[model samples]
Target: MKVNRFGRQAIVAGAAVATASMLLAGCTGTSSSPTASADPNATLVFGITADPTQTIPWTTTSEQSVQVLSQIYSPLLTTNKDDQPVANLADLPKVSSDGLTYTFTLKDGLKFSNGSALDSADVKYTYEKIMDPASKASSRSYLASVASIDTPSPTTVVVHLSKPDASFPSGLTAVNTGIVPSDVSVDSLQTTPVGSGPYKWAGRVANESISLERNPDFFGGKPGAAKVEFRIIPDDQSMVSALKTGSVDVAIFDNPVTAKTAVSNKTKSMEAASLQYHVLQLRAASPVLSNVNSRLAIQCAISRQDVIDTAALGSGTVTGPITSPEYRSDPKAQPCAKQDLKKAKEYMQKAGTPDGFTLNVMTSQGLYSTAVDEAQNVQAQLGKVGIKVNVQALDSNAYVQKWLAGDFDAAIAQNAGSADPNTMYARYFTSGGTYNKVAGYSSPELDKLFADGIATTDTAKRKTVYTQLSKELVDNAAWVWLFTPKEYIVLNSSVTGFEARYDADVSTLWKASLS
Candidate 1:
């Protein structure tokens, strides 16, 4: 959705630094010139699949990784073009005189793709469903602040919360907040969808492809690129090949490979600086990761710079865990490295396991080129400090399910999309925070600090709260933090009107033009 763009690892290069130079020199997406003149009838073809890797809203996270699910879905609110919090399903929300409640005014003429009115019921239903643990939304962090939602009327919806949730508005825009109609309490998501976005589902083509047609009455208005056909090519080489052969105009990827040969007439690309943060998630439920000393030892042993040099190719900045600058705004947010192998061993020994431990680490495949390699490097590096790591790789579909199940010791994943620091930090740090305790952590200090953050709308106060929380989260060694990559996009010079948004939704047809 925001600060949005992507690439992948396909071509092998000489070294980490060498590959990084390739990224620095060839990476695209941030257009050097303004978008071309708006061509209303322009049919801009992008490379993507109509078939979503996973249609399950709760678990189907990551903006660019899953393309259609984002466009066809609606969150409570979304980050608008200006990168400011704006209403998506709800009109700019107004807080009650009492800070505990909030009411949203619905857009009168809204309807889902299936021709159902987008009423307060849908809003209430969606929120409740997402809040339920069974829904298993990957961005379950979105509902952490929500206590409940009440439909006062068809057009007016009221939200009741345990506390004053200042970040509630921002959470609404998250992909995880996409509305669901049926009464689903941990049940499976509907195979067919009824979204309120600019595109409508035409049909699913096997497990690999899906098709979409533009909604003439899309809320923001119709997109210039009509009849979008999403062809899923799970292989990075295949995806890049599809784009290169002109079989598809746009495709989503997260490696530096596409940029390597972008000078040819495939299509221009965009490299967006994303708020999406990649982190090493240690299941708090796990025996080894559960121990603070073990976690600290693992954190110190990680070579974050290697991950950046090999994986992201020096394109993005090294940021601490939960590195969301737009929301956190912390001054001391530098990447941490727990050096002194002797000390890491000491932490392990103090945890009463001087011999260290062996664990499995799983990361989603085709998501990032460097994650697996980084995982390998991490395993080797950690071994020097006494930890043995086994790496497992899976596709996007299985990745979501396994991560939510907390089956692995460490899961390497991104924040997916939310740029709001409040949303990112609270989801993974607060007590019972959906993504927070993924590492199964319970820090009263972090909880108290995060609570104070969501209480006030004041920017300075919010920033201060977020800063303190981030520092503590990193210091505790809950997970190893890595670089926050700049969202990258590539495009042909003919394409125009592209701008990098912070909140993930980078494609807005209205703002685009063509030669």
Candidate 2:
């Protein structure tokens, strides 16, 4: 849920890319409007996936599924194209010397699309509403900070953390943490939400589509895309076909390394890695995977290189669920060590299975395919190591629900990229949490490590703590990490000044330019 840190954007749609003449270059193409160099008055039609869980910014963490998600909401802060933490609504993020408190200065003259001035009160209201149990907002974990919010005036607010949380600002920039007007009602907020973003919720066509018009009052300046249209498609292939038929201008696909080259070269559209990265989620609570040995077997048997080569389409590399090797605290840990045939085979036998155990692999049908393909490849590779696997492909929605409910032995999912490694590694490792939790993993040592890391703002100490935490997580084998994907994107040559970030959410709608 945390974004705007390091300018990482979440890719709401699962598989993101493409190019064909009929599919791309049309009078009504995605970039059909006049160029920024010419008229600069053309409408841009950007495509995204289905309905969001909720439009309530405070509650819409993974709302990238809905094209209208972040467009209708604005966070207190946002990461620029460079991925540095910068002021979106509030001024620069400030931390306490002890790292327990945070102070934010609001940007001047920022107004919601509905004309309500965005102020500290709005920030306070939105946070309290999300944190409030009665609100039942699904993504409350995003605001772990803030014992209280003191709004000294309309423009100034101070957030007091229960403990030191140096990474709190990352939460502030998260789409789910977007601030709302203090006066907006739950009913009103749900129906016709407003924000200080690039676009305003013009109207909705119910479950089918969301229509938004650019907000002229945006503090960042008017968006180049005059009018934005987002249509939800439940099927991945259909979404691709829509792009082919020109019904959709952009198709956000999760390409395997092999497919990326084709998708990138094939489509006029480009693929960019949103914050979320691909993964193989092994449920830690399951007796099968709970044993560190079983996890290690799967880690060894399944060719991480094959996954990296075939499924990731060269866009990914081997990594863990919480921490990838690239983002590892200790280079020595080297997440997901090479396949130790003898060790893996020996471990499987010690675990009471001379042959590998069979388990259902739940993956999203409409989302990414790397997990499913990885599962099959893992099945074969594990067979070599004497492990049998049964892959189960489910609807993206069903996969999400059942996997989170601990209904599967193992599942395929993604990290969706994190603004910082804290959100990437530490957040999910917490107990009784599920925003990005994989494998129902929990530990006292992990809790302490995470707590220590979050409480201390010191980079060196935090790194040491995170390094320890990463080792502990790997030892536990909570989730079988697949790889950290290098996202690919193909954009029309005309779309210039576009921002590339790590969060999966759409920041380009506002921050992106035509020229």
Candidate 3:
């Protein structure tokens, strides 16, 4: 699955923060010790930009954490590069004609690395854990439609949803709910994930590295490498140095500036459309942003092209209402209006732009590679329209906290992409929706469209409803849809079979060979 996108990370981060304290004891070092030097020919050392906040399934919102756990666990379903559902541990699920029931056939002879048989019981256990409110699994919302699960046999599992959910199958691809042995305690399961995936947990060195050894008995087939090492080197410069010295075979650079530098000898740079976008989120309650004209002025001031050129090195796609380009349809939503200082000033005057009214634009200092740069660009552009802007860089966690709490006037933040329009649109448009916390904006018409869109499985009908919602969102100037960065996956010349994914999930390591 495309696992590395910021949208999913932001959604998961909300739940992760709520349950972080509960995981401290379970995620401490395991009983196992690190093994001696891994044979280079038999191992693939991959460099990740940041350490995972937690290793436990369903408790972490960090994509880096998902990248690590994906190597050690297997989901019932996985996604292709197009974000379409694909069978992984289970065969293609058979959906009922009404679309309310889904039946999955488990692959034969699946077993956890510990040698425990993986069966329908494990699938049941996984969902039950997520459904249990006490477990506080971040995946709980994804399965909220599931009314009940029936395990008819060791190999057959059935799910009955309360209503038709065309997107239900995609939820099965979530790495947070990867199947685990039914007998293990939730506490131990969080720390020592045991699954039937291609790799087994070897050991971890906090803030430094994590190791996974190939599972010889893996159901998918043994991995190409004997072991895999994820070296967590946070700084782009440090990672570039590591790549040059052969300390790591592959490096995932969050900053395009660093990625561009990796296009040289002994390493090749690969790029993919990140299922992530940066946006200027405005709060509806803030006096400066409350008026539609004021919002429109702010939106008209930003030249997305310039922001992309400055922050992404001219390598990202400019965005509009339909942030996911792959999902855009006929009568495409109009892109942001061209920068017009005169028009923006006129709108500001109409909205009674207060004298000395300065908007605080919050952004992440280091976590988001381009947030501060983007904010500065926005500040410069908005200044041309006679609007004073102040950029404040905050810690990533604190930024999300303020965003969720609706405490900031405006901020630049990364958001996730979705295969289904309902998943992304509803959260930002519907009343009390997850992402809708920003702006405290609510639209009855848009909410109705979301309800109708997700309820009908007919593709043509769904498209009409979504297209309408997209138009409504943009007309309101709900946000300034910025740009989607072109992310690069850099690897050593000796590595093979590695491919970059839009979602950025580290699970791609499954097919990779080191030598």
TM for every model, in the order presented, reads 0.85, 0.83, 0.83
RMSD of each: 4.5, 6.6, 9.6
The local distance difference test score of model 1 is 0.64
Q: Rate the local accuracy (lDDT) of all candidates.
A: 0.64, 0.62, 0.71
Please give, for residues 308-401, the per-residue lDDT of candidate 3 as tens digits: 6665445467766555444553322543456666667777787888332578999874455667777878998988877789998876556655
Residue 289 in candidate 1, Cα distance off native in Å: 2.5
Error of 3 at 231 (Å): 1.6
Worst 10 residues of 1 by lDDT: 1-10
Give per-residue CA lDDT, model 2, range 2-88, as digits (tens): 101111121221233222222321322133225447225655555444445467765543335434667777788877654556877
Model 1, span 51-114: residue lDDT tens: 3556666666544434666667777677755456787777788888667888888888877776
- Cα error of candidate 3 at position 305, Å: 1.0
Ranked candidates, highest lDDT first: 3, 1, 2
Those runs of model 2 whose alpha carbons end farther than 4 Å from true positions after fitting are 1-41, 49-53, 61-63, 133-139, 204-208, 233-247, 256-275, 321-336, 432-438, 503-505, 511-515
